[model samples]
Target: MNGLSPSRRRARELVEPQHWVSGATESVAGLCQFVLLLRLGATLMLVVAAVLIEPDPRTLLLGTLVAGTVTAAELAVLVRHPVAVVRWPVFVLVELVAGAAIAGLMEGGPVFFSFSCGSAAVFGVAAGLRAWPVWVVQTVAAYAVVAWIIRADDVPATLAVYLTGVPTLYVLVGLASATARAAVIRHVNLARSALEAIERSAVAAERTRVARELHDSVEKTLRGLSFAATSLPQAVQQRPQLAAELARTVAEGARTAADEARELLGMLRADDLDASLAQAIERACQEWAVRTGLRADTDLADVEAALPVRHEVLRIVREALGNVARHSGAAHAWIDLVREGSTLRLTIRDDGHGFTVPGDLNHLSAAGHYGVVGMAERARQIGGRLRVFSGDDLGAVGGTQVVLWAPAGAMAPMSDRVRT
Candidate 1:
């Protein structure tokens, strides 16, 4: 059966008709142009061969003019409006006519036959499977033209080869071009699907980050305000001093919640995340030093990482710095980012009086100290681990050291990672 092959059928089933049309028009435009360029070069060679072999000057001039005109027309169509060449069937018929004209003018010469086969390939690539009938018609026309030339002129032994071999070559080249076009479109579609999946994963990770920010900042403050307000009415009737204190606490908590919400919004709207990892980290350190008036030193290496890894690492660095400013009471801080083998290590140290770190970092969440807990969660999301070495853990010296170790090729989003 001369129907669609199994591979083509499978491709048709997988891709919608509209997608096929669009992909052929957009994804294969460059390929089509390349094939047409090859055809143009072959035509020029055929013309050169004809000029040297043909005895009649007028016939040679006319044939060269015809071939050049046809080639120019094809090039114009491909260059000016590539979409029309693939989307419209008229271009296929035009190519078929141009091939017949050139082959017939050359009296079915072998070089012209090859040029005609080139036309078949261009047809197959541009029109795909839907233009098989045009290819059949062109093949038959080629055979008919060659037969007519052999019959009219004194037939040579070699002229007999064009009758059978030319049509067969046309079919083979056409099929091969069609298969190649299908493969290219399939690969492009697969790549597009993967990109879309990655985008969805990134969106989900962003949502999770937003939820975590609210939970650690505004949500906690608002919950505390709600409790204080609930107690305010009862305290006012019993003890006036307690009611006044509760009122002040509620006012401060509300303002703190508002400020945190604004800061979260600002972070979300920031485009600094697009900067290089080194620049983003160095900028974070500089901004923190300026805000807290603390001496900051950085030893950052010029290294690259995936966006998600850089994102989590930057967030963790900011969180650790915030902890140093708020809790460590350190006058000086040092940050280091270096790559060790396949692992990336970031260390932030402060020479301040450090508190006792819990045996389990998760336990700090219960005490409303979510800074370290959040930093640990962020590290884990990027398939990394964080360690806190406080003064108690590190001999009797009073200082804190926060270290994060992550894989350098951290491309996957948090949704794909195993959460503990």
Candidate 2:
């Protein structure tokens, strides 16, 4: 606890030497500081005892040598115990007996020996055993020895000898140690809080990344299959002569299931959005135009202008277009992407017979319902709103119009801009 001085406590919390660099977990600098402090305490005691109390030079030198040897022995104990900290009863006992003996032999003040035992006990507890009984014993042992020495009429010194000089110093040392122990508690709490915050941020970030990936790859694949289902049925209904061809195309889905399932599972677990939005958008426009003979024009800017935006935007466009191709009897559809002030706007309007939006989109399109529902939710998630405008009075061929405007600024910037 004596280690908890403002400077020493701060050092332990902030500047505790980290020797983990260069594959060293050993406390090289800390050990040096520890030894340094112990030697310094011993040196201080010898100098003070010699100057203040005028002890025999022989006794002074003997105390210095013995304390120094004790300091070295304590260091060896640390090496032996390492992390499995012990009570260090031997160190405390040595300090109490040797220090009291030195005082008795010196034929001088009781305070000198008291300070030595108090200093040793403070460090000894650093071997662990912060229990109150241990603290009480250490304090009482040092207190009783110094009191008894001074109380004996033979040893000659003022009552101030025991009262002011040695007891006061020991009391200050005890206070300092208590302070140190409190600081360690505070430091541990702070480190724990900081670590927990980092962990939570990492978890939330990973979840968002995972959600975006699922929306992009696996969701796109599912939509594609749904579109195929729509296209195959229509082909079969329209061209009776090509019914066999349409049936065979549908049958091929079974042949492809093995590879498709593997890819979907991989997409679910591994986050890899390698396919660019530019490629995805271009492909969507081309496919719809080629299949339906509908004039589909896409106004796509720098596709990666918004990477997080891309996942939802692509889904919205693909979903809206797919809906038009299925329900609305439309010949042409325009998918427009433009940045309007702070908002990035997307408009998918088809020149087909548009009907009232059902109370629930799922109820109307259960066979292939995920696309529209997911698109609507994705729009809301990106701080954007998706509005379906299709009543009766827009044009001669009334059709569904979906408007999705996501803030250009809020979107996660292109991959190159976000530093890992």
Instruction: Flag clash pairs in model 1.
Output: none
Please give the distance, in angstroms, between residue 305's alpha carbon in candidate 2 and its true position after superposition: 17
lDDT, residue 110, candidate 2: 32
Candidate 2, which ten residues in sequence have the lowest lDDT sum?
18-27
The TM-score between candidate 1 and the true structure equals 0.76
Q: Which pairs clash (backbone N, Cα, C closer than 3 Å) in model 2? A: 1-177, 2-176, 2-177, 4-180, 354-398
Clashes of each: 0, 5
Q: Write the per-residue lDDT of candidate 2 for residues 149-251, one digit (tens) a residue.
A: 5666555556646443554444455455545544554455576678879899867865785766565546555565566667776677787656666566456
Which ten contiguous residues of candidate 1 have the minimum total lDDT?
Answer: 411-420
Model 2 ranges with Cα > 4 A deviation: 1-39, 42-45, 48-56, 79-82, 86-165, 233-420
User: In lDDT terms, how accurate is model 1?
Assistant: 0.76
